[model samples]
Target: MQLNAREETPVVSVWMITYNHEKFIRQSIESVLMQKTNFPIELVIGEDCSTDGTRKIIEELEQKYPQVIKPVYHKSNVGAARNAYEFCLPKLKGKYVACLEGDDYWMDPFKLQKQVDFLEANPDYILSFHDCKVVDRDNKVLKEGRLAENFKKDLPQESIILGSLIPTNTVLFRNRVITCPKEIFSVTNNDTFLFALLGQHGKAKFSNDVQPSAYRVHDGGIWSSIDNLEKRKSGLNTYEQLYKVIDSKYKHLIKKALFTRRLMLIKQNKSVLDSIKYYINSYNYFYFGNGMYKTWLKSHYDLLKQLYRN
Candidate 1:
């Protein structure tokens, strides 16, 4: 039976999660509104009680595009994860949910059409995402392409668990991909954890045809609130916590990935003693064949250097 794309129902829902994004809310909303698709699409904005004028802008847009723009306005500032699991996820009425942060915008007008078509054509794939350009606060292109080189390749569930391979703003996933499990509430890196869960259900792909979206990297970002070192450390902890809740097969993969991340973080450290301390804590979760010996020696040398300096 040949499936007709035009005959497909309007079941694609775009979820926009925002908090105090007055600066970029308009552009984000406009981008969603600009999508050209044959099927009907609804935009659900999860406004997390913005102190800035972001809520006002959303209210105005909702009034103008009442049929297209549906917003869940919170009274207080709940964190992004809660706002998503509690407020946003429940309101989703579409068969597939596409996510775009309030600060990010789609570069291509056919973004939604392309992604929805892919999902309809490829039923095995649980999630379909594309490359995204990283931009700064001023909308200047900081990175012309995707953040990771491997992002363009077709990615499996394991790859998603090992690292963040999918660009958030460019993702269009099945509505059933997420269940809002309580265990993930504490995860600092929600995207990676959620992606892992989604991956378990089916495969994920980085669509080559879909137009790229613009992902803003700025100080105001939730992840940007902490430094790189802290974020990585927090991510490692999140992965460990996830290991307990996830299936056994994914447990080793998370630890192995965190082990590699710990190595990178260790190299970034200036003090040898600090590196040794980091490794000592890391030993509880990971083991690398001969690399472990080398790290041990380097850590000892650093400890010696600290002793000598004193």
Candidate 2:
């Protein structure tokens, strides 16, 4: 006798937040529409008063596929983080949430189905992500795939504090906890905070698929447009502030990551004197003292390679 096989119900929502993305919003939306899944899925888009024709396209798409596209058009720009937390995310009705920005798109038609299947089978895992390809403003493939080595299948919350291991567009997470705390709004890295929050409930999984989404790099990108020096400084300051708000046990890991970022910034500036100053400042902490000196010395070889590549 054959046992009965039951199908899972539709329980996924795709949230897209966009501003001035007329150039790429269509592709992003189409990618979600192209997804093949047995369960029902909704695409909730928040268009933040885009000065470009982004809103026009969104409206047209909504008309054509009113059943699938749920749009929120704002009169004034409330910013991405605020728009998502305050207006967009809370309205989602799915048991699970997948995110994509207007500028980035999923490459796999089964992207949502694959991630949803994973989470449904593994109840302990709060989130799942996959590798992505990096593309330049012109759509040239800068890198075939971003993940150089395979990450652990399941990563703990504290382990992810060092940096963002998962790309924003590639993540699919449970909607068990949707609201962001008021304090988190003060911090600049909302994705990190969101992922960290999910991690606390359970571990995050990296899908075996190496090609899922294409991460776009352009002048308008919030973080990508900043110079390396300023970006590193901003990163350090952000982590310091984040440490104050996060769980006490994760503070040590955050501090260590900040020191690593500081050293990288110092090296990138190509100033031996800056390195000397950093070394002096780090003397107060034994962990950062002599070890950093050796690390700095070893970094020069990689620096030369970067120079040649550029």
Candidate 3:
């Protein structure tokens, strides 16, 4: 679809990436359209050649909201990371940018306005994000309240490295606070990496008072669909890569995360060799010395029980 030029530049660009989101894309797009902001905002969608009818739906939306919706239809299915890095992010023409996946929708109409207002008032902060609700495919609220309930008003880069504290759909960050790093694409969880990268430029704020958005958990969700063990594995992989690329100050935090993941893997792993390997990897962190013997004994005991049962 050809992008319709606007008489005025958009104040915020909503970066959305979709692939096979035919079921939820409409709601996702509409939520952005419903946003009430005094400043102009554009929804820039990267439709990555969805095998389903996602592209068709986007086409219809583009036709209706020509001025507000700008979509780049990929000829082939480039994965989400590539779609965002190659197509979607580059097209953003706003002073601030927000993220929304095709499967998730915003709940609050003033979400963007509140975030932008806070950022404008507080120049020290580079990014602002709020809490969101977790819902099932049918929009049943599985969990209510903040995604990161324990998060401080001022976010630390260490907290981000430890876990995903910010919901992707609830984020509003400065457009060019830092140049998009190519290394982020190397990790499966690019959003987490991007947030960590952005955290370095300045402070990050958690808008706890703002209304929560909706985060959908479905079989089609890239991260949510996976089992707990696989999710931890993916997180471990992301942390490993992040540890190598991020600033030296953050390396310890990543290592601490790696240790925790390895310990968790030791408990979840069924294979004796894999469990032992995780135990060995856990030694890289300083905290490994604390109660590590208990973990080692427990892993061996579990393996012995499995062997006896067999």
Candidate 4:
């Protein structure tokens, strides 16, 4: 059965999670409003109490665009993690969701339109994310392409199983992909964790054909933005936190981490395959990676033990 691109269009909730993003909120809001899709879009933004005029900005936009904008402004600053995960959960009422942070704006109006068209056509696939061009606070293009090369080939199921696949800003997840109840929203980037879990349950998809959105790499981004060192350091810290969250799968991650690190080394004209050969061989039931990770784990435990002893 051939699918008409527009007929089975899914309802996409444009989730704009904000904290202290007064400067970029306007562009972000405007971006959601600019979508050229046939499906309905619900803009659910949690205006975490911003010290700046961001809340007033949201209010002004809400006044101007009453129908599209649906905001739950916090009386007090509730922090980004909670404001986004907890406060924004109740507000979402769509078949699928497209997450764009308040600090970043979508460059293409057809971003949601194109993604829904692809997802509806491909029923087996769970989530779809487009490559983003890095942009700055002034909306200036910082880099012409992706932050780093992720999923060199078209996305594979095992890749989703093993690889790190949450580029949260550009991703769109179907309601079916997210099985967690309302309470799961409090789980960190619960949206992100759900998407990866979705891939585990079903097939994950990707589009390498075109760049459908502009992912702004401002200072306050979830991941490392090239412009800021402190935020980038925090980003790495956040990455490690997520790392420890997935610590049970530490063995598998040791393989994946080494694999990607080797891939990067291959790009850099250095020999990494030989260096990380022990970890890579662990996938063949060798557990060499486990041996290495255990050493590090033991060292960490021993350090903690010394603190306790003292």
Candidate 5:
């Protein structure tokens, strides 16, 4: 899409959440500034307390560009969960709120424009997200597509329930349709919770294009920065929490994802009967887990395996 540089820019509230992203924050902000669209932007920098010098750089940028950049700086290090809940949501003031975390950047100059144009034209969709380039700390390209790249026309509701989001940065949601309730973010994994909430109310749009935004994965990444033991335990805990927050409307999709997880876990641990039990009886266990469901699942799995093999 060819956008004229002199065109008037729409008022987009760029929501950027940052922790200790001193290495990539500057490039991230610069990517926003390089957009071809002519629109007044209110850059909302939600600074989760970083021990590193990230806050200082944001302060410097804000001071240098007084009109465009505004900050929501916290005194202490509020983790990612609390930061999104308390700092960013309340400060969001644009008709179209575009999220770009401090660690990620916009690769396409027309990205904001393409998304804004679609949202403005198609008023039905309350939320929209796109594919982003996966990069490393040194700005090396790891992958070229995003979560929804597989779904160009309509993202399967099943996929949304999978809760495998590309990155928070690739999303640009309408503020009118959704807001981060403090209750929602207080959970273990806030991002998926927020996305699923949007799914509950109205339709969401996803772009299948090759490159939309840039997501930098590094040693300091949200999940990678942790120690080995804690990472393993925390990941499983986060998964369970996400399984809890998923809205009821997409229960089936969530159930499918759960089944897939069960199968994978069983294969890894070599628990065949346990896997079958988890997969088949997830509907019964959706509200709460039960031992009876496990027995039923084992019987069902054995019968199916015998039938197929025979």
Candidate 6:
């Protein structure tokens, strides 16, 4: 729908970041344009100098829907985290903000409206997100339900810090609820940090009742493109960074997550020194009350034996 000139301000701003997503950019943009909302919404895209035809498609769409589409064509590639945190976020001129990657698209036309309605009625909640269908590169549904099915209706900020429970494409949050830390731009998993930061201000709701969006898994996708080991390491780094900056109450959870990732890495590498170092690190980070010491000792002992045998 064409944005009315009378409605100078947008109620929702769709933040999209794209790089070499020529194959999926059109679908993603069209999905935002197709949203059925009573209030005006603007699409703010961060086109990070794609090496493909992605920019061309965005240009064509921007011209067609000039009122609803606002494009930030970067002269050079600044990576996804920087594009979102530094460029696109500052350009958002809406009460609420929703995120949609260039490779992912919203399936329901009322996606924005549903989340907006929920956030409007619930003042205590800072953000609301729904489930999403996991799809392959060819748009085949690999999973039919929520991205994180184990997630509950009332989400804790600690859970968000440990892992990604909410799908990025399905989230609609109150704009300017929290000032994003400069540390966020340095992390690989900026979205997780953003959600966790938002969670700190108030509460988060998981709208299972809302229609799910599409989360595409392709080789070109950022997180999907990485290998399992690299993904684990990335998560470990993000958790460590979060532990330093996040509130003191949430540090324990981040530490627990770190211990788990370190244990996994030690097992995979089978290094005796690494296992011993993990045991030492556990003592420094985790207290005796959490039973972390026992778990670390047992795991390291087994790893030490295996390493000797090898």
TM-scores, all models, native as reference: 0.85, 0.80, 0.86, 0.67, 0.74, 0.90
lDDT by candidate, in order shown: 0.79, 0.76, 0.81, 0.61, 0.66, 0.81
> What is the number of residue pairs that collide in model 1?
0
TM-score of 5: 0.74
Inter-residue clash pairs, candidate 4: none
lDDT of 2 by residue, 1-310 (tens): 0111232233788888999988889999999888888777888899999999999999998887777788988989999888888889887888899989999998898888888888999998888888888987667899877776756356776666656577889888999766777756776677776776666677788987635588999878897777767766666666666666667776667666666665566456656666545545433322454456676565555455555655
Question: Which residues of candidate 4, in runs, are more than 4 Å off?
Answer: 1-10, 147-153, 177-192, 209-212, 225-310
How far does residue 44 in candidate 3 sit from its true spot (Å)? Answer: 1.0
Where's the lowest-lDDT run of ten residues in candidate 4?
Answer: 262-271
Q: C-alpha displacement of 142 in model 2, angstroms? A: 2.5
Candidate 3's displacement at residue 141, Å, is 2.5
| Stronger candidate by TM-score (2 vs 3) | 3
Error of 4 at 182 (Å): 11
- Please provide, for model 4 over 23-48, each residue's C-alpha lDDT reduced to its tens digit, 9 standing for 90 to 100: 88998888888778665666889988
Which should have the higher lDDT, number 2 or number 3?
Answer: 3
Off by over 4 Å in 5: 1-10, 146-149, 156-159, 162-166, 177-183, 186-188, 208-210, 224-264, 269-310
Model 3 C-alpha lDDT per residue in residues 188-260, reported as the tens digit of each score: 7788778777776667888876788999989888787678888778888887777777788877777777876
* lDDT, model 2: 0.76
Cα miss at 227, model 3 (Å)?
A: 0.7
Question: What C-alpha lDDT does candidate 4 achieve relative to the native structure?
Answer: 0.61
TM-score, predicted candidate 1 vs. hidden true structure? 0.85
Question: Residues 40-112, candidate 5, lDDT per residue (tens digit)?
Answer: 6677888988889899999888776666677888988887766766667776667788888899898887777
